[model samples]
Target: MDKSAAQNSAAFLYPPIDPFDQRMLEVGDGHTIYVEQCGNPAGIPVVVLHGGPGGGCSPAMRRYFDPAQYRVILFDQRGCGRSRPHANVDANTTWHLIRDIELIRTTLDIPRWIVFGGSWGATLALAYAQTHPDRAAYLVLRGVFMGTQTELDWFYGGGAGRFFPDLWARFVELIPEAERTDLVTAYHNRLFSGDMLAENRHARRWCNWENALASIETRSPGGESPSDYARAFARLENHYFANGCFFEQDGFLQSNAHTLADVPGTIVQGRYDMICPPKTAWDLSMVWPRGTLTLVPQAGHALSEPGISAELVRVTNTLRSEAVALGL
Candidate 1:
């Protein structure tokens, strides 16, 4: 699973599809989220959640589901993507996101739909499912992340740092030695510092550090992120991580696993995802009665990874067939 080879294999993904319906939905707190739908309007409804808590949705996400079989919905979470007040972290929290998801589901008139998400998106899907298990017909999760303190510490507390010392050192170098102990908070301060220049500078470093390690096969630091995308991404991510994802305690998702027992799910994880390790996915599968885990030995965390994409698309197609058989 050379990076290039993995990418080449992704040629099998569906061609980029345009949304037939798009709109900006107001979800209170002065936050308006960008929402779009593509594929058969009458097809089985499936909402796709992008990563980063700020990654937003991309055209590629539209390609995962069979356009003829799924009515795919994609949206930008609060303060991210094309949402208004770009980079605003005010009133943004995990709970707010869960509410937003509910608002979207209700707004679209969708009773129960398949939920597809990765990384932070997976975390949100889990929370949303736990909150409204009746609304989630099924789930397709990739790069599973539970938004737990332990998972955050593993990636930011020098566990991943130990493996990617070069990039980690650079990430830490941006902060003073004293503040390095809590990099998330240190970055949070700068991301919301109000000084545009300072925020962008720290934002690029924060984003670059994650991008550099996103794919294990290709370890080269990717190109510098655009100032706008970086600022929103870094600020939102830091805002969530710094507050421990706004949860009262760690392992919140696992504690609510029973809520999802009746919901079927597919957990597709990259064996060497540097950003989100496989342990969380493993733990989820063991407890989730109807969840099946598929470990892609040749992929990393990127959704574009060939092995990961192939499995996701395959699962979606499988779900479509099952739904059809059940007359869903």
Candidate 2:
């Protein structure tokens, strides 16, 4: 409710720590991803995938796992954060990301790992696990999104628009009236227009719209984001969405849940998440074996939300004890 109270609420998170190791890994396609490792080098391996497909990993990501019990890995996906050739989407695709994850895993010499991700990160985690089920020992997902056309439409089409009409109008208003029918396409043009000023302006508006709805307590769109960060984030996210995240059809990820039958997963969702609604998470749990969904009643989509943070930290701690008994 208040600043001090809010701070106290999220105290479940480990205090922030600097990365014990950081490097720019060459993952081919002329792309070198940014990767970092924190916590104990010999701790139970946990790869932390960040959201946005572009929301690069942050120092706070390292706090989700207990430093003594989990070896946390964080990386900036291709074309984002500290990764090279910022915002360039030439070879970026869901499959490419899946391969990159494997490369990171093999390079680090981790036999297997617990996959932890949220939002778009959740989507990537699911894709990676389904592709390499044997490589993922456990999955801890938050604000689950399957990256289907319907999910994309719900957020960018008129679904989330109905709830946040004012913000929606501002978002759609940036494009020409003729182009309003397909907002993503319209924004894509400006985001990759190669005009720095145009890209920055549109990127800010795009990032602001999402940031505004990320938390239940947020009333106003956040202040302007850094131009470089916003541009890369907007471009890469738009690139993915514009291509339907390179899926065969809608609900591809959920349809492939059977592939994760041997993999146990914990899905943590925000009941009121405006972007990736609760229906997707509920649907996935019903179909996946040993999959459990925990919905936080008062939360939204942000990782920083107190309730969401608390639950994630609780999950990691619980898994730590389980890993010990299983000799992982």
**Candidate of highest TM-score:** 2
Q: Residue 218 deviation, candidate 1, in Å?
A: 1.6
Evaluate model 1: give its lDDT.
Answer: 0.88
Looking at candidate 2, the ten consecutive residues that score lowest on lDDT are: 1-10
Error of 2 at 246 (Å): 0.7
Candidate 1 local lDDT, residue 90: 87
Clashing pairs in 1: none
List TM-score per model, in order.
0.96, 0.97
Candidate 2 per-residue C-alpha lDDT over 172-274 given as tens digits, one digit per residue, 9 for 90 to 100? 8889999988889999999988789999999999999898888877757758889889998999999999998998887889889999999998999999999
For candidate 1, the per-residue lDDT at 275 reads: 93
